[model samples]
Target: MSAELTRLAERVADLERRLSATTRTARLAYSSIEDGAIEVYDNDGTLRGSIGVQPDGTVGMVAVNAPPPPAPAPALVDSALAGLDVSWDGQWANDEDTTPLDLALVQVHMTALADEELSEETMVAALVPGGGRTGVATGTYEPMWIILVAVNTSGVAGPPSAPVQGQARRAASDDILNGAITDLQLAEAAVTEAALAAAAVGKTAIQDGAISTPHMVANSIQGDRIAVGTLDGDRITARSITGSQVIAQSLTANELAANSVTALQLAAGIVDATHIKAGSLTAGLLAADAINGKVITGSRLQTAATGRRVVVDPERAEVSIYSGIAEEMQPGGLHADVLDLGASKQAGVSLSAPSLGKGTAYLAMQSPNTTGGAGSIRLEPSDRITEPGYTYLLARQGNSTTQELIESYASAPSGGKITVQQQTSAGFTWRTGTTSATLRDGVLSVPNIAVGTARVTPVADKPTSFRVAKRLEGKEVRAFVTASTTVPGTVVEVAATDADNTGFTLWVTRTNATATNVWWLMIGSDA
Candidate 1:
């Protein structure tokens, strides 16, 4: 019986050895995850072998004085970039300090070697069991090895906007923060630039329409102007600009500056007849003739040939010195110049008449009595033309210097010798000779008038006494005084202002009554 028991015990021990061998092989094949480096023991977990990462990056098993298991077949560790997890080798794990820091360093070296082909991005993660978590930080590795791990403690999050119900909330938060920081910096810089100019507005910020009120006379402008502003005349000089108004006193004293008022403003004042001092007494005031003051209207002034200019509108422009028309002042002696705007359109004095030539007819003249009326511009035969007007020259009919003036007159039916009145200007004279035509101003002017025959006998160098009567409009006049003698071939006319007579002739019925003997008497209402 003892022999039989010994044999059975040997068989039992042999079966136990086989079972242990199978278990050890199975364990070596099992995948090990680690906090840093993981180690796996054989059956009964005596640590006869280890399935842990080495510094050489190979799994090492310390073969003690014991039978060796078969060499491990090539293993395919279930390495996945996603969901990497690690834990300590639980059975015989040492304290965290027992692990050498060099072990982690070696693992980091191995990890760097494996990712050499990779850029720094993939190599940034340590390669060890704990490379999936924190290498060598917490626990075991074949009692020596460690690992570097960058574990993701934060789970998946997205961009930010605080809705909490979107896909990329966290990522959006990061982007928005970066953009807002840039914008805030720019706004800060702009605000810093604006606050320094404290004394006044730096420039004109035209918000809408410009303010049109008058500017303060003393202030300097920040920007452009609707109108000009200035200190009073005591401060500075100024150029005249339009739309500027003046408030100070006379320019000649210590008033507004010279030429300081704008031309446009002055034009307005002129039309309104507003009184204004022109400029300084000594220097810059307007000349006497410069300003078009109160609408002054008269004829062109006649120069006295000595003194000042005068108004000479003799025809249409009337200058009544008191109540009646002044006779002498005329247009031709001195020419018209310088205009003030008319009170009416007729205010500008105009003198126009229809005449034959281009000679200037300045002042129209009239005597007190006429066959027509006061306005009738006429000259009678008995009346003489005088100065400022009639001059005699040798006959040159076409020359403008010898202006031919034809004044008309008629004989008084009562035998008034045709009256030719003289104009009132000084230093001139005119008379009619005993002829129907006379040489005047380079022309033989046949006056448009008929004269009564002088009741003188036609005998040679003789006199015949006859009664000559003068009448005007059927009224007789005692015109002729005595018997007149005439030379042969003379055109004689009676000179009288008497209106007491019947129709007259050279002879009422002569003893020798021929057409030449019986004279023709001029009869008209002028008579």
Candidate 2:
């Protein structure tokens, strides 16, 4: 068995040597082939295929396939907006007739920017050769933006067209535009509220009072438009303020002045339940005897669902009457701080009102029914009114100018009425208020410093002088001719001289002789 195995091993070694010899021969055959030529053969030496280098430097092999090379990319097109100019307002143009380049411009790309940065692009067809310049309207106000790029037939976008800052054609103001002015005609921020002049507005500017219901836009005049306190009696014309003018329940108690509204001012049959808001009118809002048995009628009282009408309670009525009487007795209806008067301070004598603030007071009358009453109440300062240091009384007749009658800190007997007087044709008649001193012959007997102003007619002569009714002390006199009947450019001068406690004299001089008027004012302590 060993001899047989050795024989098999020898056979195997022989086969290996033969295989090596065959590989060497194949390598030799492969190396001996001609330049760029290759041929494959079967075991029997029959030709199967051939391989050689072609003229193109590619290795050509029989029965071998290869993918074709990829196609080259197309070149970019050119763009040019030749002869660009502003043809009209918000429009631009390019010279289409001038054919500088052979390529036809199929389409043109336009890029516009405002403020030189923000940009918008648009595409437009190029007009044929010899056609009117290819134009485009920006449809906007003069834009200062540069057209970033414009492209043409070559398909290449050209550089920005010479930094064209477009300007819109301005319409000649001197010429008659004939067309109605539209918002487009105005520039941005034009026609602003601050730009409008005061004289441009107002009633005078409006023809035939056009600033009325038909002209005014609804909800245009808001509350802020009307200055506070401007909508008073004087500003609002008679019968001008209608029911629609007032807001629903907007008029509060504080807004309504005492006795400002009267029956004459109110429209007849307009004071019904529908007109007045619920819970708006209260008893405190009414005057002392605003509503009485005669004032209240069957139609005035509202009837409930059960047909029962509202009635005032006797207890409430009595309380209101007593409260009103107490308020009137108080000095100026102002609540005063209680002073430590020891036992001398009377219990029922002290009078005050909680609604009256310290620094303010109500003008009250001791006996309103008595036109010329003996009892008078003067205003007294409370602890809160300490800044002023002293109290003052201001008196004014119906539509007459208000005058500071008295200023003092002198106290009077507790609960004793202070006697005051109002100027009357007969003489100074006793009224419902107090002064620093008593009155005599229609004037205060005490040293009364008063300010008097009066218009004096100037004499046509050069030495024009007039005596004022009010007296002056220590030459405390001032005069000014606020208005005059003299012609324009006429110079006039007025002077106050010869001042005395009894009266003061006013002298005048005029450059151009003309009748004129002068006003004078004097301050003195002569009643």
TM-score of each: 0.15, 0.18
Per-residue lDDT of model 2, residues 274-377, tens digit only: 87889998988998876555564333222232222232333322111112333333222222222232212211122333333334333432321122212334
Encode model 1's per-residue lDDT on 198-307: one tens digit a residue.
74553465444454335334334433553455545664434333223343442344555776656643554443324434442443565766645656454354444343
- The global C-alpha lDDT for each of the candidates, from Candidate 1 onward, is 0.32, 0.43
Best by TM-score: 2
Please report the TM-score between candidate 2 and the true structure. Answer: 0.18
Off by over 4 Å in 1: 1-261, 264-267, 270-283, 287-316, 319-377, 380-527
Error of 2 at 418 (Å): 92
Judged by whole-model lDDT over C-alpha atoms, candidate 2 comes out at 0.43
- Residue 159 miss distance in model 1 (angstroms): 99
True-vs-predicted CA distance for residue 309, candidate 2, Å: 44
